[model samples]
Target chain A: MDYGDSPEEGAFRDRLRRWLTEDRSWSSASSTDDEYWTRQASWHTALFEAGFFALAWPKKWGGQELHHTFEVIVDEELARAGAPPKPSLGYLIQGISRFGSEELCDRFIPGLISGRDRWRQGFSEPDAGSDLASLQTTAVLDGDEYVIEGHKIWTSYSDVAEWCLLLARTDPDVPKHRGLSVFAIPMNQSGIEQRPLRMINGVSNEFGQVTFDGARVTAENLIGEPGQGWALAMTIVAFERQPAELGYVARYAKTVSELEGDVRSDPDSTRREIAEHIAWAHVQSEMLRLHVCRRLSERLDDPDGGVHGSIDKLLMTWTEQSVGQAARHAAGSATSQAGGDSRLGTYLYSRSQSVMGGTSQIQKNIIATRVLGLPSN
Target chain B: MDTRLSSEQQALVDVARRLTERLGPDGVVSLDDDDRVARLDQATTEAGWRRLRDDDGDGRPLASGVEAGIVASALGQALGDTALFGPLLAADLLRRVGIDAPGAFTVALVPELSSLAVADAGRLPAAVAVDALGATSALALLPDDGGFALAAVPIAGTERSFDLTRWVSSIPAGTELEEIAGSRTLTGDDILEVEAFALSLASADLVGIMRGALELTVDYAKSRQQFETPIGAFQAVQHLLAEAKTLLEGSISVSQHASWAVDALDAGEAREAAAVAKAYCARAAIEVCEVAVQVHGGYGNTWECMAHVYLRRALLSVSLFGDDGVQLAFLAARRMGV
Candidate 1:
């Protein structure tokens, strides 16, 4: 049950912690929305160059091929040191590593991981909430090129990304799960237009729609097998709760730092609840490490279908929501308003975590039908 | 830096689990009945657990190679006691770490199970020793010459404590101070050591108890149905069960964390880690038991119901070994460096 990091892993985590804490970009600097995003990309690029990004991918794909511990060490250290997260950077590295081809990897993986380019998700259409499979965005295959024309809403950092991991229908004849194809949509392409959709979660900085009208692109931008986008998606998001997601590293440290914050002025209920929630979150992290350690020790490379993994996901998503709720509650009514440091934004972002990666409802369905072997609806 | 458990230590946990199963589970259910209370009745003194720990060399711990088993055995035997495992494990660890107690006599007030004196004075026979009401019968303040005697008192109202497989006795203020070879008083260094031990034990017990409650409720939800299909098939009930599983799983995490923390005492972060773990376990255990009962329907509320056993036992644990309030103070204070 000992889930402690190895000496080397510990050393790496300390190094990351020291770097993140010492770096003014993540620590002392308070930048405008534009400055923050651009600077974050630069910082991420630095990390990518350091071989600390996309650690689990094969070396051939510009990854270090290190153990999951390497990733955990980085995430945990960054989180504990109060380093601002590089969401776009994380997404780009992992996306390219998993779904990009040899050509794509050759062109993007090294630079993307080494923090050269920013990435955004072009998954959600305005009408697609939980019904993502019903995305109306269409991509017509042409001679050695694809004509893409559609609108994707809630596509985070659409305007800022150098590339977009867009999911489109190339074969609508197949079922929703099989008809889709994922492409490394170039955000800088001529026909593509990004419009920021400001929300309560976004800081008036764009988490908007990507309109691809007559967007022309070479077939090379396609990621994974065409028509297997959903499966590829499941494969990627399946790693959401895995150690690769920084469940090993960042999430735990985030809780600890939050616990370390100045929350004493809040109500007793708020303070106690925050403390309890942090502890619970810490527990969730420990469980993740235990499950991961046991699996790694036994060399058990089970897929996400295993009961243990589901249990980990269930615990994580639930606690994520709970902690988010606690943060909101602890802040009182003002937390939801436009003012005050974006507790509301974080709360909103966290609410969608369960829904975005996998909703609690969907997760339970998986646990009952697949993990517990109970019949489904 | 090595937070990884060695294979041998991992095996030690397995054996501990096995032994706990053998010792009559120290779970909520064990704390649930007349049988538990009756078993702890002073009538069983000669054959009871106090004899096992306080026994002469005739006991198993003194035997070579059996010491590891003793750690597991103490955990198993004190399943209901909740407070003994810490001190017992600490004593074992002290030997393992080769750190001598430096004295032949000192008393450990299982904090949760026993009370203590604010000031140390001479010995004299005092009136009566409180039994910590029986959560721990390790030792109590008593009076002698100028100090106090150690007398054992039976815990009141706690006969109903879940997992009543063990016994508790108060040692009056001034009971004759027997200088055992390794009797280390609850002193400065020993306090942290024992605190860690106690928290770890309670956390582990919560994990086992929580696992049991979840199983029971899941079974009941499946067997007892309302809308044609088993209620467990319903999303709402499934959600309820999911919460229990989440709580149980969380309990396992923190509980195991505390145990592992104890194993790595020099980490500097160990005590704070243990406190956090224990505090979370207290809340999770309570929630698990309460929800487990809710899931169990009417059967869970019965006087003889096992669910109540776990519930009551979990409640008792909340206040012991540094209650949630105590821990919150310790943790928040420590984090603030106050």
Candidate 2:
């Protein structure tokens, strides 16, 4: 029934905020692929060393074993203090802890927890984006190893990561969900090359298509079971449904705080739009807290659950595109006349949030068929 | 984050189900007629339908009112009785706002109605629409900065088509209607929330009707023979029936989600969620009802069959609150930050 954090939780948030503000190692541009992989890995190691990354994870694996609410509190507090994003590796590590096997965890979690390395998601192929079932990546079993050969599009930060988290078909004759396996494949091996995929947003010199040709990785590298990759991929769908501006709390607060009164000023179309954006922002922030409530309830209800993650994913994508649109529309000439380094450039760059993760139409399809109970066809 | 209903909410669902079951499939059909309004009147007075709202003649709070919405959603999914929603929702909404609406009060449904015209100083609905209407008791007039104004003409002597579930009349051209009066100002988000509430309730009722049609056709398909095998066994009939099941389930989910969104309205997100749910539900209801007729074969074409009623209701329900386009526009506008 309580809508937000208790005093105890608030204090915990304050501690996280203080730490982030004080951490000289944390850089605003740390998430960019151009950043040195070794430096990012070292930073991630520091996070795990301090028990900042895996606080929500169980203690058996050198984690603080806190609840997701605590993790959420950390995220919010970090944002409050303008903390740089915890490396993608740190975020994806949670997915592994949720779905990876003991063997896989043993091989990866320690290094990941210690920030020795990171992994990229090799999910989409030429023909597979919304129709993920149509992915053509093939992984053939040879005694104890899966020799994978396929092209993965939109593998963000692949070149910067030590490994790629790949989804490949192992049993093509079965249904799509039953034919796929998830792997943490090391990318430095021969026959693996990542070619940058040029994007409309100019920020994607780091993201590219990765081709894995006869890339041999042991069965031990498989994160989940041979055919349970779909479930594992869906493990964090609820996380995707987070509110409008996620970890960008300090930035969002700064942007909207500067624009609030101008939006209310009379005699222009921008006023209504800006005011609406602020209103939307407030609503989105509250919904994020509500999302926290939904997340908190998961552990209490179904510790191991089956609710689809597509709904969350879809909502998150929508929120991202929306906030980006609001920023530009509210900023007027400042958004369009970009020359010197300004937020307008960054605002425009945020446009790919939907297309990068998954398109809006694809999200709707997921909601319609999987979440809303409509026939897929 | 915990959206799971408490055990008390769960019990309310159970109690509502028992009531729907005891009342049977024909329970909703009975409510469509003026004579059958007594069922809800008595039920609302008794223990089941108004568990939250009709307590000791005092109104339920907004949050409890939300629980009631969830109950209605479950009822629609289970029994397919779409007829009883209007009065229940109108009365419940009235209760949430602290308005002491009567047990059998009716609501305004004219599409052309607007609060600006109603609340304007000089203009008003005809006197006949206000007082001497056929059967409608109250109007949800719009209030501008001044007095509440009659939004609809509700013209009398227009030769009524359907009367029990709804009514028509005329009102004075410039009379000042009653304002909500109590100290409450609905925000834009609140407006969207109410719209979502109303639409979700209606769409749940639509689910009920769709289920009723599916049941009717399925029963026919089972017993009725075509050539040699029961029509139900044929692939053609099977596909149609299966499709109906998908549609019924689809509408059920949207309606369910929309209800949950409003019930747990931690913020204004319910508006878009509601719009999405309403748009999908509207499309599903039409699809299910249309296919229901096709599955029924020749008998479905006749007015003697109740399939036509489902068709009529489906078409009517699509544009009742707002059409698919209007709602999506509302949603997409907000989404695009326009």
DockQ of each: 0.23, 0.09
In candidate 2, how many Å is residue B95 off? 7.5
Q: In candidate 2, which residue ranges exceed 4 Å CA deviation?
A: A1-55, A62-103, A113-116, A123-151, A166-183, A189-191, A211-267, A271-299, A310-377, B17-41, B48-51, B54-63, B71-338
Q: Which tens-of-lDDT digit does each residue in A1-377 have in candidate 1?
A: 34566787777777776666555555422122444554666666667665667776678766777665465556555665656543434434555566767677788776566656666777778887668898888888899988898888877655667877788889888888788988876778688877776654555454677789898767888887788788766665555544445342354446445644645443244455456554444444545544444444432233233444455666666556655664565456675566745444446656655665557677766666565544444
Put down candidate 2 lDDT per residue, B22-82, tens digits, no spaces.
5433533554554434453355447545434432454434345436555555454344332
Which ten contiguous residues of candidate 1 chain A have the minimum total lDDT? A27-36
User: Candidate 1 lDDT (Cα, whole model)?
Assistant: 0.55
Q: Estimate each model's TM-score.
A: 0.77, 0.62
